[model samples]
Target chain A: MELLLTYDVSTTTPAGRNRLRRVAKLCEGYGMRVQKSVFEIVCTEPELLTLIDKVQRIIDHDEDSIRIYRVPKGSFRTVRMFGTAKPLPHDDALIL
Target chain B: MELLLTYDVSTTTPAGRNRLRRVAKLCEGYGMRVQKSVFEIVCTEPELLTLIDKVQRIIDHDEDSIRIYRVPKGSFRTVRMFGTAKPLPHDDALIL
Candidate 1:
């Protein structure tokens, strides 16, 4: 499945900054960064569960928001991108 | 239907800034702003189509990306929000 992951992490304190970095790193491991705080992840069911679990653990439930949108494979056809950023290369094979 | 709208508008030029403002204004009409560039919208099928059409016209298709995710009504139960932002109030009666 293809997933669009977007998050907002509070950065009012040093701990919050750390959590932000932690969340970004965890997301990077599972997918490619599409923007500062957005990622496009292509993963299987198990991988998706693991990624969500790891992110949930790192973020403070009271101060952060992480939204995962499950998109059907090949649905990028409807995704429109203009300017410098290109759409996620959906044609690439998933190693998993 | 409920929609999650997210967009990234290029601001490298004066015209781009204008586009950003226009896009923001268009979105504000159809939903509540969740963040700088995110919104939670509650609308009917026709409203959704109208919103998308207006947005697509205001944006520079080559320089902006707008994504709309459709979520079933009452599905917000899975939405998790931490920190200062609260989840979109799902119980409010839709005047439409």
Candidate 2:
């Protein structure tokens, strides 16, 4: 399954800044960083659990926020793009 | 339709910071800010177009990016949340 992970790690303190870096590094191991704090990951249920566990350990529950969303198949078609980033490549039909 | 807009407006320069603030302010007019730079908006196609137009004018094509994603119906069920933010309410089986 494809998952989109979005997070808001407080940076008001030095420890919070470090946690932000650690969390981003952990997620980079599993997915592509589509936005500064958003990642697009493709993995199995077990893998997802492991990633979630690591993130849980790194964040302060009362100070940070994290949300993981499952992206349904074919959702690429619903993305509309603008600006510098490449619109995610999509090729639904191509006859040879 | 429901849309999720994510943006990365360069903040290294004064003008970029201004653009970031402006872009965020504009999005706030139409939706809820879910993350530091992400918004969840519920609106019509024409409304979306107006928003897209405004955002386009504020960003620097070579330095910033913006992406709008359409949220599929029932996607709220797919959200797995953690931390300070409230898990969005899901009442799929509520009988009361």
Candidate 3:
């Protein structure tokens, strides 16, 4: 039900933003926004497939790329525990 | 020192695979291969910037998308504990 879609767009041009907008729109129907350019799409299997199809159609530019990583239903939440900016502690002692 | 580069290519064509090959080649200069299409690139900050530059040059197809996630240096190792297919346990008791 949760997916991590990480993508890159050619920030050098307007076309890139347009492509990203399409991706955002596609995600709107499925899940909540997580981080910048990362969406937490919550949906059933069939709906998620439809969302993927819609996303593929909207992303027509070769300069832009998106990867939809399906984390075994619950991994996404754990990854979020650390947030995005804080790097993990090098000492093994820091892990909970 | 570890980064997760998750990419999607149009498996429908050879161009997508070629783009991925470029990505793999780019990663070779810095780290070890972990899983299929995933690498554990180890390098200093400057080296990583250079690798990203090379990756951009080799990948020219819009049909394929790649996302390079820089883990907080330690998170990748924990994720590995779960492997790729097992879903996280719903009960917090399973977490180490």
Candidate 4:
């Protein structure tokens, strides 16, 4: 399935900052960066679980939040992008 | 339709930073802030167009990017949120 993952990590402290990096690195391993704190990932159910486990371990429930959206198949047809956010050839422009 | 809006605004210059603040304020008028740069908005088609017009006028075509995703009807049932990202009582939890 296709997923839209976005997170907000508290960065006011050294620990929070470190957690942000670790979470971002984990997300980078599984998907394309949609923005500084957002990612688009396509993975199997098992892979999704694995990714969730990793993220949960790194985030503080009181300090961070993550939103995982299931992008309906073909929903990309309705996606609108402006300026340099235009899809690249190898990006989701060809595949969702 | 329901919309998930996100933007990346260049903040390297004073003008860019000012645009960023203006863009965020504009978005705040139309939607609920889901994160630092993400928003969840529900509006009529015409409202969406108005928002597009306003944002386009404020952003730099070369340095800024905006993405608007149409959230499928009832698809919010599948949304997964962790920590502080959970839906609130008056939020899309009851609408959309």
Best by DockQ: 4
Better of 2 and 4 by DockQ: 4
Worst 10 residues of 4 chain A by lDDT: A87-96
Candidate 3: tens digits of C-alpha lDDT, residues B1-96: 555554444434687667667776667656644433545556676876777667667665444444555555544334421112222231222111
Candidate 4: residue B56 lDDT (0-100): 92
Per-residue error for B83 in candidate 2, Å, reads 2.2
Report the error of model 4 at residue B19, Å. Answer: 3.2
Clashing pairs for model 1 are A62-B83, A63-B83, A82-B62, A83-B62, A83-B63
What DockQ was computed for model 1?
0.31
Model-by-model DockQ, in order: 0.31, 0.55, 0.05, 0.62
Q: Residue B27 in candidate 4 has what lDDT? A: 75
Residues A1-96, candidate 4: write the lDDT tens digits: 777788887555899779878887887666667666777776778888988988999899887899988876654445788867865221432221
Q: Which pairs of residues have clashing backbones in candidate 2?
A: none
Better of 2 and 3 by lDDT: 2
Q: What share of the true interface contacts does candidate 1 keep?
A: 0.26
lDDT string for model 1 (A1-96, tens) is 777677766565898779878877787666666665667777888988888788878888777777776655664556544344466654553433
C-alpha lDDT (0 to 100) for residue B76 of candidate 4: 50
TM-scores of chain A in all candidate models: 0.77, 0.77, 0.70, 0.76
Which scores higher on TM-score, 2 or 3?
2
| Model 3 chain A: worst 10 consecutive residues (lDDT sum) | A87-96
Runs of candidate 4 exceeding 4 Å displacement: A10-17, A76-78, A88-96, B10-17, B89-96
TM-score of each: 0.64, 0.78, 0.44, 0.79
lDDT of 1 by residue, B1-96 (tens): 666677766565888779877877777666666665666777887887787778878887776777766654554555544444466654553423
lDDT of 3 by residue, A17-82 (tens): 787677776676566444335555566778766776677676644444555555545444344221
